[model samples]
Target: MNRINAHNLACPIDGALLVCHDKQLRCEHGHSFDIARQGYVNLLPVQHKRSRQPGDSKEMVAARARFLNSGLYEPLASRLARITSALVPENRKTSLMDAGCGEGYYSDTVFKYLEDRGASSGLSFIGLDISKPAILEAAKRNRQITWLVGTNRQPPVTPASIDIILCVFGFQSFEGFRHILKPGGRLVLVEPGPDHLKELREVIYSEVKKSRPQDLTPVMETGFSLVDEQSFQYKTGEISKHIIADLLLMTPHFYRTNKAGREAAAHLEVLDLTVDIVFRTLEFQNP
Candidate 1:
């Protein structure tokens, strides 16, 4: 069943340790966050929220759920699981946090992969996102993970405690990550490569500029050194209009594109896409 490592969580308001009490998370400073009926927790304090709604909207989360559940991205998920499994300690308890885990597709898939390999015992999985809608959707995928609605700038996980942090195409707070990750802990990032969804970009943008996926030099200077990097790429034969729409909705391009670009996409009966992803692992080191 799903369980939470409440022992590692902190109160967003006071930065005090939080524990599960009476189905709520309470800290010593009297700060309490409620665990929703869906079994996820809302740890994002109102003060920390940038707007009335901070992260992805409900419609975006729904589209993300639909696209992910369709298994078109299963190869990516499988590669992530394989990479994560290699980093897990064999005999010790470990904690993994999926920062900005949208609807829990990757986390859930990784959990099942580890479980199938008999490597899931004594592991705590946390799925965190700024979007309540995303966390709400994630909580339904697997009860084994602790899903929280919280911002990355101030993640509630305790300092120097997390074993691994996995972020996929999300905004990151490197300072926050450095604070929470243990020495020698790994940070895995999955970023889009230069040609990732180029076809889609061609349809939606007046001009497309393809560049490096990311530069880790700044991150390396911040106490994290690159450990490994791998490129994963694939092409789909043809996807239907409905799937294409769902894909567009699940990405930021939907909001960035003009109406004419969107209408052009809508009229396409089918389109093939190139999925280029870079999987990088960086290790946090003590100063």
Candidate 2:
């Protein structure tokens, strides 16, 4: 694994500043973390861990990997890459951090886009997740980028070190994101729109709760300025039973689906799923 500048790291043990010496990251208080041979580091302290295994289960990870590899979400990835690259300046070497990168699908796609455009050499990608297994799997696929097992509450990266941050259909820690982003750094958030997967939702639950779409005013209040927004809707042609099962496992709806709903999905002949993907780009504001 490549050794990152310790100056860009913080002590997960005490939240103190970290210093790098001889390929090791050490805190001012003498706490130390070692870089792994695979070119990544573990910043998650044991005390902060609530479980022996954190984050998505192995089964969920496998299901997600399989579903994503099928290229069902390739169009979404392409849009993300296009928007993110447009926001970043071409002259500067950029660093992108995916706060909840699961299985590295989107991050890998974005990195490949930069490479294909001859812009990858100046860019560094980091995928961070609370799930150790997910990070481990991501490391195997992209050796050039960094992978860390950590939480969004206290991102392991040093303050003001990131140029672009991505939060894609995952958790978001607005305060943590603001702390790590450089001045004028960009943050891209991808969320499921109101009409997202309505077909699946209708089948999974007895009563579909209709709530107003999320308001971005609160997000902007947290020291970010929204720059651009776009919405895309597409129908995923009739899907098979096996694909339905994988989709169930890959989303939170699995647990919320009623017994009747599951039975319906199981017996259904085909599913024509519709997705409304929303993307928002925000920039960090000066304090």
Candidate 3:
């Protein structure tokens, strides 16, 4: 949080600059947001919320945190950091935003990697998620990360203040991303591939549909051109029943699964699964 200055933040309502002092963020228009006891700030205005509780629930957040802590996705995290670090230009300070950052796992990993490479002084890390529990959990992992319970549709960040935006297995707000990124800034996107957890799907569902191919056309329409993309696959060796249950809980399928599917996953003894993912780099180009 120390690396994020007041200049980097904006009032969610009026888009005015915010000044942080005494754990409170205030704008010139008299809008004030208090930093939580957990060190995260809530910038999600009620008007922007579609439900009483938007985004991942507390249970989902906990499941993801627990699963990620097991380091099953460390390869994806490392690749993300490597790709992001390469996209950020050298010899200058850079601001990075992790849009829909879940539990700060990816952001924290990337920040640590950058710092180890002697880029800490020149990098600013901001992690935003609509879920308060997720942001609170994220803040606990690294106090230096600027954690915010904010909507990605309208992030609480100044226009053109960010150099790199990361949208990993989360929502992609093209306009919001473009508004906050400087011209030529990059967006590193990660999405699940067809075989991503194929074994789990097979075990849980009677008919496991093949994953569809991603169309970059939508991204291109948002004033971004694809720069680079890489697909990654790794084996989980032999996973335990506990991990199987955790994996089910961590995915969206958990909500849609039937009682039988749930029981099958819960009763699994051992399963070998493949972790398949794709990373895409898109550079913003103003028309």
Candidate 4:
């Protein structure tokens, strides 16, 4: 792990600073998390766990990895990279953390994108997820990124040390996020738009509810102001049955769908999917 990046980590037990010592991250209070052979660390403590298996399952991660690796979401990834790169100036050190980074897809893509753009001023990329399987799969994407098995509620990161926090189609705990980001730091968030996967929803449910835009009042109440916003749609050409299956597994709708709904989706030969996404940037206002 990079020394600077390691400094950004904190103890999950007590939120104390952590030091990398002998292949483990140890805190002043003697709480320690061992580095796994896969080059990631598990920082999730038992008390913080919501369940025995908290986050994404192994099967879900595997399906997501397969789907993402196929480059179906490359456009979204590229857009994220471009937008994020534009936000950071080229001549200064920048620390970016991905909250709930699954399989490290966006993080890896953004890392490479910044490198390609020659913003070499010093980029520290960290990805954290509650799922061990997700972090393990993420580790395979890029060893340079610090992947931690941690939760958004109690992120294993130093307070006010991050420049940007990326929450791409993931959970965002306003309190936790506000605590970790430096003053004036930005949060780049990507969420599903109303029309996102409409066709798939139609197949999965008999009646579809209208999709409403995400309300940011709660986020704004936490002393963050919206800086910019954009919405766009990406339509896939002809998607195969295998890709359709992957899509179903990658989304939350899969678990909520009825037996008949799942059967209908499973029998699909091909589908042309429309992916609508909304991007927003919020900057923290230091008091």
What are the models' TM-scores? 0.97, 0.91, 0.96, 0.96
Error of 3 at 276 (Å): 0.5
* Model 4 clashing residue pairs (backbone): none
Best by lDDT: 1
lDDT of 4 by residue, 74-183 (tens): 99999999899997877899889989999899999998888888874488888999999999899888877888999998888888999999999898887889888999
The best candidate by TM-score is 1
- Number of backbone-clashing residue pairs for each candidate, in the order shown: 2, 1, 1, 0
Per-residue C-alpha lDDT of model 1 across residues 44-80, encoded as one tens digit per residue: 9899999999999999999988888878899999999
Candidate 2 to truth, TM: 0.91
Off by over 4 Å in 3: 1-6
Candidate 2 lDDT, 114-146, residue by residue in tens: 888878777767888888777767777777677
- RMSD to the hidden true structure, all candidates: 1.2, 2.3, 1.5, 1.5
The TM-score measured for candidate 4 stands at 0.96
> How high a TM-score does candidate 1 get?
0.97
Superposed model 2: Cα runs more than 4 Å off: 1-7, 16-24, 37-39, 210-213
Report the C-alpha lDDT of model 3 over 214-243, residue by residue, as the tens digit: 788987987899989898999988978887
